[model samples]
Target: MGKWLGMCAVVAAAVLTSGAASAQSGFPSKPVHIYVPYSAGGAVDILARTLGEVVSKQWGQGVVIENRPGAGGVVASQALAGSAPDGHTLIVVASGHATNPFLYEKLPYDTFKDFTPITLLASSPNILLVKADSPFKTLADMIAQARAKPGSLAFGHAGNGTSTHLAGELLKGLAKIDINAIPYKGGVPAINDLLGGQIPMSFNNGPESVGQLQAGAVRALAVTTASRASFLPDVPSMAETVPGYDTEVWWGLLGPAGMPADLVEKLAHDFVAALNTDQMKARLTKLGASPIGSTPQQFDQKIHADYEKWGPIIKAAGMKAE
Candidate 1:
């Protein structure tokens, strides 16, 4: 009887191990959720919906999006950190995900340990926009005025600690000016205020500002990237004016930490596949975004690199969450 029981125990262990392996291999046994830490129609939200369509078709399951926009992505990030580490739940986070740690006194979750990067979806240079008929004619002119007036000139950003906000701060640091920085709950409000002449200028991503630029409502002084955006080639890059200025907003996929290695691999591969499709590439290009399908390791390294790069900037600027 003892010999028979021992054999049964060994068989059960192997079966359980096989079951666990099979479960992970199968992946997305149910519907998947990709959280967006911004309001609808924003860059991250748009990319999530686009990729969700492709991935859902591949998985034959719904890819629901939940938009929890506030506190510079803290609200949604905390929710993602609390979710099960299973492959079903993920967040489409912006580059602000890396900067939050430096902007906030404390975060609800560990930025590195509480998340797993899948792959970066897209990136766009923040456009430096002023009203079409504004007096400042060139990048040099704008800097000169800001230098002359100091705190009299102000710019609007999406929110505190966001890429747009940081871009504005970077300009201050690099140009050695005293332009007041304003934070809005969303980019739309800031752009609206700019149109209303409440703020002299604003930093908005390509997607949000493209229509305004097309309508001749705003003029582009320079794009925050080191290179001119493909969609706006006539516009010069900030580095062309500020010498070392370079800032671009990026979005990526991240799941709750502790997801199985195989599951993470599959997610990254599947997302990269979706991003590489010709249809997706064209669609994103129309929105002034560039598709970037990086490996899981590459995406992880990107977060760490940005975190290191932006930490000192945020600290020196004395920025904090509102």
Candidate 2:
């Protein structure tokens, strides 16, 4: 009887190991939830919904995008960190994810340890926009005006410590000019105020400001990228004038930490495939975004690189949590 029991125990161990492997291999057997840590109708939300539509079509299962906007993306990030590591839940985060660690005193989730980086989907350069009839037509024009009247020129951003806010600070540091930063709960309100001439200019996502520019409501003075944006090639890059002035708003996927390695691989591959599709590329291009389908390792490196790059900037800017 002892011999028979020992054999059964060995058999059970092998069976359990096999099951574990199979479980990881057969992930996404149902719907997957991709969390967007911002309000609906924003750049992140728009990207999530677009990607979700493609993923759902490809997988033949729903890829629901849940918006959990608050706490500067901490609320959704924490919720993702707390979710089961079965690869069912993920978040589409931005540069704010990296900057939050330095901008906020304490975050509910461990930015690095609590999540598995997936592929970075796409990126868009932020544009400095002013009312269409405003006198400033170029980055040099804006800088000259601001230099002549320090702190008299005001700029607006979606929120405090957001990428737009950081862009403003980076502009200040690079140009050695002073322009007051006005914060709003969201971009639309700030855009409205910009149109009303409440503020002379603001740093905003390329897509968000595209329509306004086309409608002749706002003029894009410059793009904060190394190269000119494909959507607005006529506008010169800020780097052309400021030398090293490059800032962009990027978005990517992240699953709760400890997700099965197989699932992470599968998720990354599927997302990259979705982004590479001609339809996806055309759709994103219309929104003034470029499709970037990088590997998981690449995305991980980007997260670390951005975190290191922005940590000191946040501290130096003396940004406070809202």
Candidate 3:
């Protein structure tokens, strides 16, 4: 009986030791997957591909970027939530992620509870733009006309519940002007309409709109940032007129909710390190994205804050899922 008990004790100890050893391997036994909840060729897509390249170099493993665009990021969010929590699967979401809770009556997953915050990659302020030939040369000019006309002027956006849409809504609430807001399937269509003179103005990404503004196809009236963008230092900030008006469409990384704390720390550390590299910065700037390297906790705090702030705005605007 003593001999049998000793053998059993040895087996139990080996199993526990092996389990702990596996746990201590620090996750990511294979390639990592990053789900992008927007269409390819958009800001989120560009940002993810750039960052993924950097992360791939760092990890020496494949980092797949999967696009699951639909329902205002619901499909991607839900897909990420269902992925394994072993730090092998992640998602890069935009500002729309925060407002989805308010926009949709029912989401397939919980935004806050189902994901572990990684780090915010970067954020860029949206630029208010109009066709180059349009008479409204400045924000003041646009505001005056809209105020005078009272819902006659029109603007275009990517979709409802998106950053562009909220920017317009915030403008309405703050400026008390009545300009019409038009939604498009994506930025390409919106820019197409803006260039065709179908829409008077548009709220597009600084990086994306810079080319058009430079080519004189579209004029940038104001950037939604509180301060001037480095790329467009001459463009005045929207806050110059609308006090306390600041809105930036941001992108961030997230993993499954139960990701091991060590793996989370390592991922955040590597990502920020990659962002600090000269090559990464240059690539991001070329893509028109500003690099913002933040801690996981800071990203989480921003998510929570933005979630609280956008809830009322979405409710007041009566924004619905598109």
CA lDDT of each prediction against the hidden true structure = 0.84, 0.82, 0.80
* Off by more than 4 A, model 2: 1-23
Rate residue 149 of model 3 by lDDT.
91
Candidate 3 residue spans exceeding 4 A from truth: 1-26
Work out how many backbone clashes candidate 3 has. 0
Model 1 worst lDDT run, 10 consecutive residues: 1-10
Query: How much is 88 displaced in model 1, in angstroms?
Result: 0.8
Residues forming the 10-long window of minimal summed lDDT in candidate 3: 1-10
Candidate with maximal lDDT:
1
What would the per-residue lDDT of candidate 1 be over residues 122-226, giving only the tens digit for each residue?
Answer: 788998899998998888999998888878899999887778899998999899999998999878899999999999899998889988999999999999988
Residue 168, model 2: Cα distance from true site in angstroms: 0.9
Task: Kindly provide the TM-score of model 3 when superposed on the true structure, using C-alpha atoms.
Answer: 0.90
Q: Model 2, 263-292: lDDT tens per residue?
A: 777777677777767887887887788877
- The order of the candidates by TM-score, greatest first, is 2, 3, 1
Alpha carbon lDDT at 246, candidate 1? 84
